[model samples]
Target: MIAAGEVIERPASVVKELVENALDAGATEISVEIRGGGVEQIRVADNGYGIPHDEVELAFQRFATSKLSDASDLDAIPTLGFRGEALPSIASVARLSVVTRHADDDSGTRLEITEGRIVDRQRQGASPGTAMTVRQLFRNVPARRKFLRTTATETSHIQNMVTRYALAYPEVRFALDTGNSSLLTPGSGSLREAIAAIHGLNVAENMLDISVVDERSGQSTVGGVISQPALSRANRGYMSFFVNRRWVQSRMLGYALEQAYHGFLKERRYPLAVVNITIDYDQVDVNVHPSKTEVRFRSGDRVFSAIQQAVRQTLTAHSPVPEIRRAGATHPAYSPASRQPSRYFWPIEPFQPSPAPNAERTGELIPNEQDAASPTSNGDGGFTHKETLPVLRVLGQVQSTYIAAEGPDGMYLIDQHAAHERVLFEQIKADAATSAPQSQSLLEPLTIELNPRQQELAHAHQHLFSSLGLLIEPFGGDVYILRGVPSILVEVDPVRAFIDMLDEMAQGGDVESWSDRAAYSLACHAAIRAGKVLTHGEMTALTRQLEQCQQPHTCPHGRPTIIHLSGSLLEREFGRR
Candidate 1:
């Protein structure tokens, strides 16, 4: 009794095993409808090779299967539901009923089972297909029934499983209805079309195809689509990996993908991907897990390498992130480092900046050295701006840090320090990538005094520092002499930049990805420290440089760079619209 209990864990598990059986029976189109999160009823209808009326009763017997005829078949199992445990297992727990007709049969057969025993069997007229309905799952075992989650959560599991099958078999049409919601997958045999139908056209359009077609590598083939770095999710929920059309969650594969997107995404952010790895049945062992979601591969490391290299190549071929950036990438209207702190606050505009009356051009608010106190706009924190949108105009500085700006669509509050950090991070990465880390010979050598441990660390990583364009050498004792700095930080304090990089390394990050890690550290410390006023030119320059960055949405540390207040939202708040 508990054996069947292990097979059908929930409504989703029932749906999964049933669907795999339908596919194994050569189904072309399948429809899955679940009610009460599949606890109440699960109806799966498939147009496939159905069982004969005489054998319909026998199929409910445990270990009775047509998949494996001999012992040797165990070494090369290809069918999904070969163990024949699904039907009997499912029958043992729920009120199970099946109606199926073979293509050659004159009539269909319906069988009902309770507690793994065949309770009823009858002949009926039906189309050439199979339809199974499972009701009152875990009814006999009230303990299991009590463990089921809410309908909504269980519905997600079923939906997620159906989506996996839909992706695995693009030629098969799949429809899923959870309560009133429905998902229809196109049976046109195009993975992109399937994705578009399920995830939406925008996500599909943004995906880049990874094809290992013709180019053979080992005993498997790999092909799928991965999202551009610009499209990312906070979790790995969007990533899917398939081995021989079986959707399985493998952490080794997931880690490989994450490693492939090493510097492309912010820490903790994951790229969306649907990777399908096709291999022969002989090379993969599918009997490892009760759920059949975990499998053992003959050459696991090779598979990992293949996935990593394939994804890396695709990203390199077409990436939206910019490659090279230099210092002073901002616009010319502002200079933050050189601006002087003003004594008085400038008067700000009203809560909402009304458009200029009858003016042809939207008069810009260029951040200048004037006592520019602007009106308190509560609307600033609500809007999220895209990089392609119109750039905002700098309206001057506040608290010697934030840059006030106005855009055609809304007003923006820009964090000057964060903005500079993003700018420098990009510049450093670009410079480092080309192995041309721009260095500026300091007029007077900056000596950095470090503790004994830090001094030892500095000496150990002296070659690394030289590679990063930090021309540093021990000046004896617990002191290091810095003669040059990366051009991006040349104007900033060299000693501060060096100390910050060391501090970041101390905090724990990949020193091998020293370019990116060091860049993050360098950008953070060397950025315009808050409380430092910006000149009009400085502010303008920063804004312009920011616009040129690939990912201007957030700083290197994942903090937002700009906050916007849409004009319409402002009007709505003010009762104008």
Candidate 2:
């Protein structure tokens, strides 16, 4: 009972250990059945090489393992089960029975052990594999049994474990039946297909493939699939990492994944990914933990760099503009991030100041000369994409918000506010790099009051403020004077924009630097608000500038800037195909 505490926590632990043993035995097909959340009955059947009839009795002995012959083999443990503690530990806590026939044996052996004592041993006709049934788990340890959760929760845990293993070994057919519902994977040897089976087809379609190999070392390689920025989840539960085909819990892997999506995911949102890292057995130590889910890498830095780079490169290269779905369309079952945030917050004419007398009638919130100028970039900005969309031809504006246009392959709808924000954010960062942004002194400086925390943030981020053309000075206790603001925000309220910056810096997660946080807020404040009518030339200019942005797909806030409606999709919607 004491040993089982470390290896068998609940029904899920038993399933995990048995599955790992089957995998080590080279099983190509595995099936698992459970009742009462695997506490009443649990069965795992596999077609792997089984134990010989003569040795079947000795298999339950503690520390008896075929994976390693000597202590030196511990340094380079290759198989998933090496200590051989699973059988004995589990037998001591539950009623266990095993029927198996080794490949070289003409007959099979059956053993029924209850509470670590054999009750039945007989010869039987059986296939060349192993079938283990654990019944009345933790029956001998009433304390442990009392601590188990409800049956439904335990079933979810077991199902999750099985799905993860199926992802790691796509070539192995896996099935789990809880006597209520079941899951099956085809073992098609395709990662994408496996993902579709587990997460649904819609999510699988949006996943991007990533593969990176260190040819110089010829020992480490990383490969997997990552969700597009549009297909994220609310938690990191979707991220899975495997080392040498063994599922492991790794904080470094999680951090690397989040870092790769720094500005590409919303607050508290995490990407969905299945990343597998393959390296030499000697390069990683899997015995760090009793469960074997934690690994220590010999070259932790190299592994981190490889994972981060692979995910980053895949995202930058393959991320596409989100598609706009019609009403009543089926939303992806796996994605909560696809639903855009509410847009009603962008105030309309009620919030705009009076237009200048000679301002052009360009459908902008502030019909001023500043809003009419086209956005600019400092470097050659178009990416060398594998499949580039043709230059868009501006059609017209939709609902005074979305810019409807056409391309060679499909139609495009661009969010004017989001597109402009993307453009201005890049420009702000670029200008900050070269020189301070253009600033205009106010006729009379505006004074504002801040709390102690905000005041501290202001003093610490003055350089970032100056870069965005926001010049501030401490006037007195908890008070500051804003001398000038960015040229783009001359017409907007400088005081509100300044306060917004402080709030962002104070509340924003520490992943982004103060400068990025400042630029993000500044761009959002200065960008043209939605619901403004734009002249044809203004619309043309907006889309053209958007195309020059390095990351034209999303705004700084990770909202989609454009939605593409492919020609084939349009045809299907129109009943033409």
Candidate 2 residue lDDT tens string, 284-369:
99888778899999999889889989988877666666665656777532112332222221121111122232221211332234
Per-prediction TM-score to the true structure, in the order listed = 0.68, 0.82
Off by over 4 Å in 1: 1-5, 53-58, 69-77, 217-220, 228-232, 259-270, 280-283, 298-302, 305-462, 471-484, 503-512, 523-577
Q: Mind giving the per-residue lDDT tens digits that candidate 1 earns over 448-539?
A: 89987677668778766766678988888888888988655645677876887877677654445555667788778667778987788678
Off by over 4 Å in 2: 1-5, 52-55, 69-76, 218-220, 262-269, 280-285, 296-305, 332-390, 433-448, 466-476, 480-486, 566-577
Candidate 2, run of 10 with poorest lDDT: 345-354
Note the Cα lDDT for every prediction shown.
0.74, 0.80
Q: Cα deviation of 380 in candidate 1 (Å)?
A: 46
